[model samples]
Target: MQSNQANDQWFQSAAARDIHLDQLKRVERFNGRAAMLGIVIGIITEGLTGAGIAHQIGLGALVDGYAACRTQFLPFCF
Candidate 1:
């Protein structure tokens, strides 16, 4: 009975750890996706639209990408 109780506590902690790891991975994937999206938008905006409008999407995408990356950047590296 005591061993079973201890096992339950370990499972709870492991579950919590898994959740944190999953969130970290998700944030990372989004960061990379956002960066690529921003670059593509910038190119299309300049190529088809014009420098001004292209820059608008480009800048917006860049900011979003940075924000996403910042979320996990430090923890990911260190």
Candidate 2:
């Protein structure tokens, strides 16, 4: 009877551990999605208002393209 009780206790603890892990994974997913949404909003606001989120996306590519054009073709670069 004592061995049966011990088995029951072990099963309970194992089940609790699995539940805790599942909850942790859910929380992490929620936090990641929330953070991504916030960043997207910030980027859109910046794009619409000329705010300092200028460093957010493909601005670097634009700049590099412009520079290459100026050096290779445009005479007005000076």
Candidate 3:
């Protein structure tokens, strides 16, 4: 009787684990689809705004200058 009870408990635990794994896999699939959708939206928005890759490089330069000023504690930065 004890052996049968132990086997029953083990089977229940295994079934529960399988159900949880299925839910996680479904969630991961949804996340991947959502990420792809976001990338498409970003591309469309960038195209409509006319901010090309060159504009992005100029922005990066400004950010780098700001970082250098902060690190040097320059008076002009204040």
Candidate 4:
């Protein structure tokens, strides 16, 4: 009887682990799809607006800041 109980516990733990791994796989797939969708949208927006993705998102200031920082030899500039 104790041996049967041990086997049952081991089976349950294995099943639970399988379920968790399946869930992780599903989440990873969803994240990958979402990232691809974001990239496609960015590309479409850039094409429509005739602006690069960085410019559309207002990263120009950030780029300029980095250039300024490089010239000034600053440790940190944003």
Query: Which candidate's lDDT is highest?
Result: 4
lDDT of 1 by residue, 1-78 (tens): 999999999999999999999999999999999999988877887787656552474575666556677887544422
lDDT of 2: 0.80
Clashing residue pairs found in predicted model 4: none
| Tens-digit lDDT string for candidate 2 (37-57) | 988997788878775453455
Winner by TM-score between candidate 2 and candidate 1: 2
Cα RMSD (Å) per model? 13.2, 6.8, 6.0, 3.1
> Which runs in model 4 stand beyond 4 Å of their true positions?
67-78
Clashing residue pairs for model 2: none
Model 4, residue 5: displacement in angstroms? 1.2
Pitting candidate 1 against candidate 4, the one with the higher lDDT is 4
Ranking by lDDT: 4, 2, 3, 1
Whole-model Cα lDDT of every candidate shown, in order: 0.77, 0.80, 0.79, 0.90
* TM-score winner: 4
Q: Which is superior by TM-score, 2 or 4?
A: 4
Worst 10 residues of 4 by lDDT: 55-64
